[model samples]
Target: MTRSPATPLPPPKARRRLRETAALTQTQLADRVGVTPGTVRAWESGRTTPRGRKREAYAKLLKTLAEEAAVQAPEPEPKPKLEPESRPQPQPEAKPQPEPEPKVEPEGKPQPQPDSQPQPQPVAAPEPVALTPAQAFDALYAFSAPALVRQTFLLTGRREQARESVERAFQTAWEHWPEVARDRDPVGWVRATAYEYALSPWQRLRPRHRHPEPPPADPGDRTLLNALLRLPPRHRRTLVLYDGVGLDLPETAAETEASTPATANRLLRAREAVAGRLPALADPQVLHRRLAELASNERLRAAEPPTVRRGGERRARLRTRAAIAFTVALVATTALTVRTAPTHYEPPVSPGQAVRGVPQRVAPGALSDEELELRQKLLDQMQDGPERLSPRLE
Candidate 1:
């Protein structure tokens, strides 16, 4: 059976009236509607409209309250009034209509005829207004941050890393706002940054991340996520951007900084690896579906737009302070270099050290008197007699 469309909700003011007349507080209404008090408030205040089953339930509830109000407050009885007698009046005559006449021309002068065809007027396009850095940052963050957080989470199955990656990307974007804002695809710029941060080899070394995060509750999800994680980093990224994020081949290649064929190869290998584990996901569509479901099912939500913008600004300010401090340090180092530099030419100091470990030999004494006499006798013997050739037979 086809389900009828949900009843449209009443105006915000009338909706509030219905709730008030029904003596229901926002909390009470929210409880009955299966939503939060804040959602109910937003509904009544017209900040947002309720959707799906919630919308049906809310519409039915308001309709019931209105009907009840109508029943309880009956209409008042009609009152009688005095009627006055009246008389008839006069009639009038029709007048002749004036017609458009052709103009008369003087002899020998040429008469100009009106153009039968209508000319089209050119329309000036409205000028595009430029956004300030903060506004642009907020806009970009709002558009891409949530999906990015999820994408990062898929890339590295860690929630904290996912959030941190996006925030860091936006921070970097804001830090280099001029370049980023000027980029043809700022979202792509931010996404690339976030992806790089998320996929950094160093992130795996984080103390908290050393142990794998808890897997999805569903066995299939757990298996799929494990399969995704098992792929090489490059392959996994290509798969996520290609299948999960629905990016085309060339765009995925561009984002991954690889040639199209290389990206295709990585994707093929990644899918094969994933399919090896989950044979049902061998088809690309099924793989994409599973990847999306895995990412979506996680309890991932990014910070509000303002919070992200504020964080980006905070990071930008920190970078500015760091640059200023670095400049000051550089200036100080330069001054110290100038002050302590050698005043004049100087010989280079030798760095060589005496060789170690070998024994130092003592030169023979010039003479103890006996030793000198012995030495003189030996010298005389060598000069006069044949050299004393052998040590005594020892």
Candidate 2:
């Protein structure tokens, strides 16, 4: 007869769970397994594995505990099902019945009879058509670009930069259409990109942006914009995402790449700054409304999809060309350095002194017979040049 295979032990974590589920302590399990408590701890932590008779005993105990745990595990709630969909209802048995005598109709009246026919089945709805990449990109851009631009405006407080930021972000999305389309939230992807670009630290280095743009005509709006610009970038981003964009704290933390507590700290500080500047606008709801109004009131507009796609293609081509050029230049520079570099060191030649000056040497005039003849011939050729070569075409 063939022997049965030995049962394998569960994982380290599962071992601890099995022990706990059985209401057994490490020491108790150690005694049952014929080992010390430290050995049990090591086994549970995956630091060591039991062997020989000990291994079989431990496995057997774990198996029993696992069975108990399975018995104690709660079952999932049952799903409600439709009778027609889930299965056909049980039909009642047919029985013989006494036939009633037909009544005679008076003067040209016809008797009615019941119709025997099965009801028609319900038809399922047709599946929706999947979108092409270009079409999907167009839809995403048309839906989100305008509002994304406005949100970026709130972040940077610049109408021109906000429009630029949104356009750049959309262009980036078009370039990576496959990845963006597969993303769970394409809108969020574009929004995050636009927000980061709009608030980039390098943007401050531009000469035109050295000073703040002209303030809004409304004093209230001007105060709010100034207050937002005054706060640090992280604090402002957290506040805008949490309050302005209506994102929950966890989402805001995730997008900002900060811990929940840190994000909360930033939001609190930002609100205090804005509230300090404008006392009447202390409530977060009011602030959110004001930010929306300020963004909507601007004349910001996005370029069309075709324009954005072309721009993205152009930018990509430019980058590719630049990379090629840089590589060629680097190769050329390396070749030149290698060719011109001295392989061996040489002592410098000392300048010859007068040595009480032997009479200064003189040479003949620069124009030799061949040089004079060549110079004369060139002059004659210029004088006899064709009229087409004349300075005046006429």
Candidate 3:
């Protein structure tokens, strides 16, 4: 017959045994349980007991330690035999005590009670801070010009056009620094602005029919740019700002002038579209290589001096400046027209003295629509006068 091995016995009821079994110094365990070595000594001496879960944890811990150490427990001492007695004696019964009465407080007097332990209070979350306009602008320019140009190329599918668009956008953003700088996502803001200009009526109406070739990827990056370029202008801008650039929803929405939910939807659709197209493309490595090549080419292109490519970028800068000047001129002209237009004040026709129709004097500058209308009305009134002025006697 097989015999079962005996289970190990517990260690001696001493503080040293606890310290050794728990693999902790008496001071360490006391500190951990928020007690002192003196209290631990009382527990180990059996003069006091550990309370609650800590006692169970410590007891089980010691048991596990003994098993791991493979120590054999000594046999328990045998109880002494009792001597036989001749006769039993009757014992007296004790009477039951009355229950304690509840305490009552007098009216209008508060009862004093011991203070309880303090409850833990929750900490408030820190607030999100906003960035200043100047700071925002600085952050945007902090991106290397090459990186910005590469991002533009990936979004637009044409390297030269992308570079031109980015340059114009930056120039415009710089000119309106105070305004664009207020934006939380200045990079995204500039990107969207570039997309708008690239798809503007003037650009669409231009005679050139050149189309962008699909970008060739390099080692580090290989995403195809064509998949993104095929999206509708707004969707493309939204996707490029979110997925390509890694802007959060709020920032993307602010940049695109779209609601957060709308921006999220656009990004989802854009991603789905790209994912759908990617399967047919077969090798993802090719796409990554093409993107890397695009980035490297963009870096090289940006490093070139502006004077060398003055023909293209110079024209772009001139066009942007002209557009700004024209916008300013248009606003000023509109304001002047509104401010100088003649007020429609009818000269209170004099109470008596043959009140004839009055003629209006045109302003020194070009005639305004208001002035023309007033003159026409006065002419009609004069033509209907009671009698013709005998040709205004000289």
Candidate 4:
């Protein structure tokens, strides 16, 4: 015989009331109580009763449902009232008054008047001092941009790129002269600016260039220093800032926009990358000496004045501009003359023509039309031959 399906427990009195107040269907009540719709209907119709613990739980559920229903139901609104009527009154008349006369003072005596408050005059503000680029450079130089740059390079391991970033930082500081000049620590502002500039996209866009070879005169310092310089600019920046410049972990992290732990990890890895390649740098004193050399070298100095005659310089500049314009116009005219000049034509070369040739550098007006055509055709064939001609040849 097949086994009969087990009977579901009956719903309790509280569950029946909860289901009615909740406006839940028999199926909804059955699903919540873990019973069937038929069982919920049978219990609500008083044909069955729920057992022990389920009965107690159902009572608590009914109480919560009733409370929810009470909160959600809307209250009855108040009724409107009728208005009362009013009575009318009387009108009043107008009255006129005479004009007052001006008073005359007795001989040699002034009339008394109300005390008048004195008005304060506005004060003028002082003018701002204009800063020259040279002055800006000097102020930033004392604060150690070179050391900051070298440190950034050591940290990032990209020397040339880092230097450009540092140069750009100095340029920006120069542009913000008024603010930087007033700072209690101008050097700190410059260093922070340089470090932030290095992290920007403009730094990444700078043309990559060769790192200068370590100064050979310092043989004692060449090994480790050379390897350090050879590393990529960003890594070099990181190492320099953390190890060479003696920045604490948090400061290094701040400049690099990295966590202190990440900064420490980078420092460890950079130290290892250079340790084996340069023996001198392995020694702490050697490393310090190399850093000192770099710090002294990486500074922005004032540019030397251009050589020019002192008196009547304005007239000299105008004369120079005139000469440049005149030269450009002459060259343009010559080009037009040459283009519009008549040209002799030549027929195209025959197939497999065993052409004998002399290779010579042509002066501006040396080549005849046929010669120029032949030379250009030969150049085009050489440059765009085999790799590009396969389909056309077939």
Top candidate on TM-score is 2
lDDT per prediction? 0.82, 0.83, 0.61, 0.60
Q: Which stretches of candidate 4 lie over 4 Å from their true place?
A: 1-138, 142-167, 178-185, 192-217, 230-234, 283-286, 294-394
| Cα shift from native, residue 24, model 3 (Å) | 58
lDDT of 2 at 173: 89
lDDT of 1 by residue, 24-53 (tens): 877798899899877876676444688888
Candidate 4: global Cα-lDDT? Answer: 0.60
Model 3 C-alpha lDDT per residue in residues 26-60, reported as the tens digit of each score: 56766766777666555543335665666665565
* TM-scores for candidates 1 onward, in order: 0.54, 0.59, 0.38, 0.34
Candidate 3 vs. truth: CA RMSD?
34.8
Report the candidate with higher TM-score, 2 versus 3. 2
Give the per-residue Cα lDDT of candidate 1 at 54.
Answer: 91
Tens-place lDDT per residue, model 2, 1-394, is 9966666878665787688678787789889989987788777655468877888999999988888889999988999877776787799999989887556688756577676698999999999999887788888889999988878877888888989999998999888888778666688778878888888989988886977677788887787888888999999889889888898885676567554578899999999999998987789889889988887777888889888888999999999999999999999999999999999998899998758758878877788899999998787774756556447566
